[model samples]
Target chain A: MAMKERLTKADEAKPWYGELPVESLYTAGIAGEKFFRSIQEKGVFLGSKCHKCNMVYVPPKIYCEQDFEKLEDYVEVADCGSLESFTCVHIGLDGKRLLEPMIVGLINLDGASTSIVHMLGETTVEELCMGMRVCAVFKPKNKREGAITDILYFKPTKQ
Target chain B: MGNRVAIVGAGMTKFVRRAQETGKELCYEAAKMALDSCDMNLDQIDAVALGTAPDTFDGVHMKGEYLSDGAGAFGKPYMRSYVGGGTGVFSVAQGWYHIASGLMDTCLVICEEKMSSYRPHPQGAFLTIFDHTTERPLKPNLLWIFALEMNRYMSTYGLRKEDIALVAVKNKNNALDHPCAQIAKAVTVKDILNSEVLAWPVQRLDVSPVSDGAVALILTNETIARRVTNKPVWIEGVGWSLETSYWTNRDLCYPRYVEEAARMAYKMAGVTCPRQQIHVAEPYDPFDYKELHHMEGLMLCGKGEAPQMTVDGITQRDGELPVCPSGGLLGVGNPIAAAGLMKVAELFWQLRGEAGKRQIARKPKRGVAQAWGDLMQVGTVVVVGI
Candidate 1:
């Protein structure tokens, strides 16, 4: 390898920053629409039962990821669930410290074979434990929207 | 298989958090260096196999088509494969089929990722990787999934954080000798334990850095490999497997997909026992715990045996079964696809006795490189030897 003298004067800097101005809107399919509308209208959780596989999906999908069978029958699930896994996030997406750490958990909702990822609120991260029973805290019936935000967060609940 | 295939040459750019070069420029640099290494020209290449992660990171859709000309694929039979993070070794597999199936005598495989193009943070692009209907509603980040998996793995094995931290300590230290290492440094278990936590059980140090880099490998049939170079590294076997997209349904403690992929590759390579047959190994380590997870997944050791192996210093660069002698994604940078090809390239150097200070003390012959990607759904494995 050969070495060359460094330029005493730096070259002019020319920089360009571009962004992709894009947005996406999705229509919740039959199963998804039923899953969300149930939460919004009834303040209750709904799941799709795949009778062939005997598997229930929380936040239901139209088809079973396992058997590829369409899931048409919807079943009601209890708001309470057991925490399968949890994480306390301290960093924000913008590479900054979050205003406050958030506790996120994967909860296996009652009667569902698959877990749902959601926020854990009304409890301290240090106090969070795997297998802890928690219940969804939903917005008031009059204020509920037909979106995931209808359920404000999950909180520790006494069995 | 139609014809035996081997890697004739490999090249990579320095792994960095950001690069001044564009994605095309990076691809050209790595391709040129790889061609130079084997004293071969683009005209000799019969096909091109390009591997890259999501277009989200590059902020460009159809990343393969956009990057083709710079990869020396102008007017050539070019194909691209995407398996999220597994695209690296998967590209090698794609090229292997090109030569092994007799469709092409010589194939140039290139993997590149320009993660720096994604603003705010490259990880922002990862948010949409979750199911738009269900998982995205919670506003989750990628680290959350890793943490959840790490927690499950640790809880199942009854392992301590200190024991898991050993992977970071070992890999980062080994990277000090790598020419393209990005965050190479000496660290201790105490340092890792004290590092700021990005997610519970996952600290800032546990993760690989966001990187912008490219890696290229020239693969050819046995005849061309023997004719082009005196020390050709034969790709003895290739295997890839994908788990269900329903990540939540599976037990996160073990990566069954990696094990299945390794089993297929090992069977093809005629190796009954991975632990005894494979000499040097490069398991993916995007997070420190992932190294151990993949080690077990690769069947290098029994389930829960990896932590003890780490404690026994068996995973050290000079150990009996040296893992990640290339510094891995953790010590090097994780440009997704590029990071995986870098491991294959490292195996080439190690087998060819050209790894310099990072070479294993024992001149081993056989090696394996594996990568995992996408909602923890896919595993890509490649077996190579001198």
Candidate 2:
């Protein structure tokens, strides 16, 4: 008999449930704090450069992964980026279809050796293309919190 | 037996309530200091062993892999050791087996913890350590467990609260000489008994503070040890024991698991008398009574007699037998895994005569460091000698 033929329907199955009762207050680390602070106060992107690895990391790190060298050289990264890849999610975490498809993009910021994954905005899935140029859409200055969400989403830039 | 293993270098960062650096950065700093201590780099290290507590403490899942590269494990054989809080000293055993098994010529052992990342207080994270089906519903935190154990130990031996409080006094005073000590204050027994009681019999002053830090050590085979440094502290023996998870059923007064683990290490180290052979001791002391509890488990004294040693000044650094000469988790700050390794690092420093002011009285021939954790279910012991 096929394995699929012996499957039980979701409604017929019983499962016990428990949630992890843990709340975290993570420190922004030395470099992460500076990066978030720069975005919150100066409205600039902060990055760290590893001279030994010849790599630049957006959302800077304290140490380089390849060489284990201390990465103290901070740089200002360009707010604009090129979309490396992206996905449009039709289903939500609760196993229900979303009212509107949410688009997420992996973007490589200028002067950065790495990319950041963030929500995409102002464009449909059909219009999204690889290597598409996008600019950061930040929230109001007064509402700025030291968090990645301070930049609401990435908007597609006009040609 | 496998090839003999020795710890050639040890290094650690200053223990703190909250650290500004990331977990990886803490690992890098300690790893670099350890490697630099022996004037060697990552090239000489064949592998890396990392030890850390629960992922909730740092808010990073798979913490071992995230913090591995910075511990000088880049493009090298890397492994993580875990035994709840016993991970720190167990990490040394991991490195020992690597070289002793003839797999790696040199291994770097690293332990790191950042409890401040947990919101409100770090103790909330330990709430999950209780059995979800049984104890979690009771909302029993660490203090409650220690209070229960302390009360049991006191009642079993008919000891006084004042006698138990002396352990805190002696350890905090010992920490005064340690540069990395966090809460090293010389408070009297009256102060401890008068301090705010979080749980009955478990005062605020009786407990170690939540902390963040990292420690690293370099271990190698006998052949490599000969060339590394003049004073290489040999790993005489290592042992660990884990009792059943049903801690409710066990007798709280005595830790049978600790005695079993200590006996195993003593057998391997060929020591019949721990009190006579072991020069110095560093037992886990997150609470004042724990130092005494673990000492009795390690067979250093009769059950309920450790407090008398503390009161008699016998455990003093200049006395007959020095215990927690590094201030232990009580005064040194407890970062879980990092605190355990801190004891082993103290043993290394003491055995090599490198511990400046905190060094014990005589030129010690041997020393033992032990760590206990996880609802009082496990005990890890490591014996080191010059």
Candidate 3:
């Protein structure tokens, strides 16, 4: 009787469920434009070297973050690098692991100051370990879209 | 600082997984309680500082301006500060500056987070917290980063899964005494290890539940504080810092930003040795391992000594250097920014000898509450005393 009396709202009426539609297109700006363009055209990695601090930033920056000086030198960085840290993930964004378990790693590119996070391919989770050398596998030139995705996952360079 | 600032009152809503009350309503409830506790009116407050995490979870843009009315911020010098998860303590820090700088005699700090409003699981909102161009394409579920960090921490420290499980057991048990705890349960290490693994190192029981809540603290200059309340918790020091957003660039084993922030606060608080000087600590513990990670960062002990401290009963409510006596985010809920403010409120209650059942066994003179967030970048620390 108490429960029935407490039911003021109709059972059929549901809480409103709506979404905030967000559509965003961001320009790479001065630094990112050059980095993505280089990946699109040359399939090479370019790091911006700060003259003041001498810190090279991969996926280069127009200005130095630390010293606030313009980064003038463009240095080439190798795609082959060592894995700093990694994890074997079983779940996707949908909350279910319908696909195979994926291994992702933070790969510090050679001659670059910062590491980039990307998927690890052509290797098993058991064999994956930090400090293992890996090289980037790029998508075919025609299919490249001037994005970080130009380099398809990274694979172990050696056992 | 021009003048000393102290916290005259504190208040918080019951942390829950979901709430019928909207964000503004939550803010109003906490703000009203804080004002009532100090026997002050809305008009008496000189300024207001608000803290809330990303707008993505609330589904409202410019949340500061939107929630201002309910937070008693109508036509006043209102400011909002955010550093991802560090927003709560950071807002309190901002409030302290308002009074200490002789700008405002009385300042109100309010933190609110309504995470339940985000549809399709609130974790879905965190998908955008990662790097949009490089990392977002990898399709990460927030758990991946936690698991990765936990794995790196364990491997570097030579720790087992059971070592960190002790934090979850202790915090949840401590939450049993909290009046507004969300998921306080007397769990064990076995229960945590047996819980379903969302990611490799992270389990269901090891993580704090998503929550909806708000907390408020009333800060005033020493003169105003003495007039407002007989017992006031003084804000001794505040420090905050952020590491590079390029999280992968640095080693995840140690939170350098947390250490830097703690060092800065300790220097200001005149705490030569945190382990001996600080009586209690509530470092951010959204994940069980994070508590241990933050203890190390706070210089409570050496790099790998936190897990052992938890194991040896040194961090118990009755133990020396009691940690997370308020049940922390693990036993309490994780509403992001609100969670941090809740820790600060616990310190206020604890220092004033007013925390009924959750009071520390050893009467504490000083305590530290800290928060860390933003892709493992930001650290906010506050030292409080009676």
Candidate 4:
């Protein structure tokens, strides 16, 4: 029988890397556009609430996770919501260095139970808190045509 | 149950940093090998279950459809499922469900991943896994999350960096006998410490290399299993659970999801105490520290004790619990979905006494394999008995 040989070891330590192309003017799906239009035109966000468990999902989902049942028609949500969690991002995944840091937060939209993830702008990291109330900011009517980008960011509302 | 499901045969392609074969071809190679191992053909399979990780790794959307024909799912009851790196074991669990549920008597379970397809770096795909609007802006690589967890683990247990490096050394050494290993090296603590740092506490050597490969298994019910082989490994129990996607809101030091899943599986398998009853374990180890993280989660040892046990050689092949006898993802290679199934295949071989040089000294009566994925939240567990 031939002698058994062991596997060879790998040499040459190499740095890990990845690349992605950047493009402007992306399109949102029809359903996604409809949801965004409500925010831009009426300052109202919509989501589907599960009748089975009373679990609300913001940025409406087609199906409910609790019962795996299809959701009912759209339910309008209040423009203001509480900040559930937030993070400050400093680096870009595409290896594209960023000039300024960006703040992202999960907002628990009012009248809906679940939090909707979106950009939190024009606020300092210290000013953001879990229970802080904030309202969605929409783009100018002339620039809005029903899209997620219609709400550029959510800013803290003055009580 | 009508019939008990067992994995009768398994096969894997060579794991490599890169492979010229397309993702479909890799699946075909492994599926063909698995079929050949059982002295069976694709036509004999009652169904097919395909498992793969993120679509970003392969640079193809709906990768399951692209891989269907190659996985021998053409015109068959086919379904694709994923739970991040847990996908491979989750695939096998789905196969077990089909056989146990009596929907199909025989199933071909195949898992394939080709991370090299993502140009520049595989790490880029990881950005999409985080909270897109919030976490993505931080520019954190996947390693940062693992590093944060590792730091927490170290602080909680007072463990040293060298203690964790031993896992890399042990797994890599174990890979010496594995034919499919991609970066199997005889590493030392110094070498690991000297390796380039990615995120603090996580070094280059501590992580598994991004690889391309596939692993396949043939699962059949008890009647068919007995007819095929004298010693068949039965899928005694399988369990999987997914935590809320809000990862940062929870503690990262311990994986409660894994503990829940393991408890469910152990209950079904009639295992009262895992540390004494389970002979082998293959917890997901994409990063060196993660192996320890998962070890504690599997309840192999009490919280804050795995790192100490690992340093004492308690996890070696000769130790009481021979963890990662297949060399693990840290040394063998990580193709995401394939790595998880590869651990199951290792347990199958160890239980059968067919592992050759990597075989454990003690007779493995029972084994447990687990995979974790999805922002470090989802956990999938499987327990096999000989």
Judging by DockQ against the true structure, name the best candidate.
2
Index of the highest-lDDT prediction: 2
DockQ for all models, in order?
A: 0.01, 0.51, 0.01, 0.01
DockQ of 4: 0.01
| Shift in Å, residue A33, candidate 1 | 50
Positional deviation of residue B62's Cα in model 3 after best superposition, in angstroms: 1.0
In model 4, the clashing pairs are A17-B120, A17-B121, A18-B120, A18-B121, A89-B137, A89-B138, A90-B137, A90-B138, A91-B138, A91-B139
**Per-residue C-alpha lDDT of model 3 across residues B1-386, encoded as one tens digit per residue:** 46899999988899998865667667877887888899887768999999999887887789999788668787789988889999988998999888888989999899999887777688877887777667776777889988999999999989999989999999999999999999867998999999998998999998999998999999998888889899999998899999998888988999999999999889889899999999999999999999999999999999999999999999999999999999999999999999999999999999999899998868999999999988889999999988
Q: In model 4, how large is the Cα lDDT of residue A118?
A: 90
Output the number of the TM-score-best candidate: 2
Query: DockQ (C-alpha) of model 3?
Result: 0.01
The C-alpha stretches of model 1 lying farther than 4 A from their native spots are A1-159
Instruction: Estimate the Cα RMSD of every predicted model relative to the unseen true structure.
Output: 24.3, 3.3, 23.9, 19.4
For model 2, chain A alone compared with the true chain A gives a TM-score of 0.87
Instruction: Kindly list the per-residue Cα lDDT of model 3 for residues A46-132, writing each as its tens digit.
Output: 999987667888878655534334566888899899999999999989899847998889999999888989999999988888899
Per-chain TM-score (chain B), model 3? 0.99
| Comparison by TM-score, 2 against 3, better one | 2
Q: What TM value does the first chain of each candidate achieve?
A: 0.89, 0.87, 0.88, 0.75
For residues B289-366, write the lDDT of model 2, one tens digit per residue: 999999999999998888888889989899889999998888889999999999999999998888999977698989
Q: Per-residue CA lDDT of candidate 1, range A57-89, in tens?
A: 887865554433456798999999999999999
Native contact share for candidate 3? 0.00
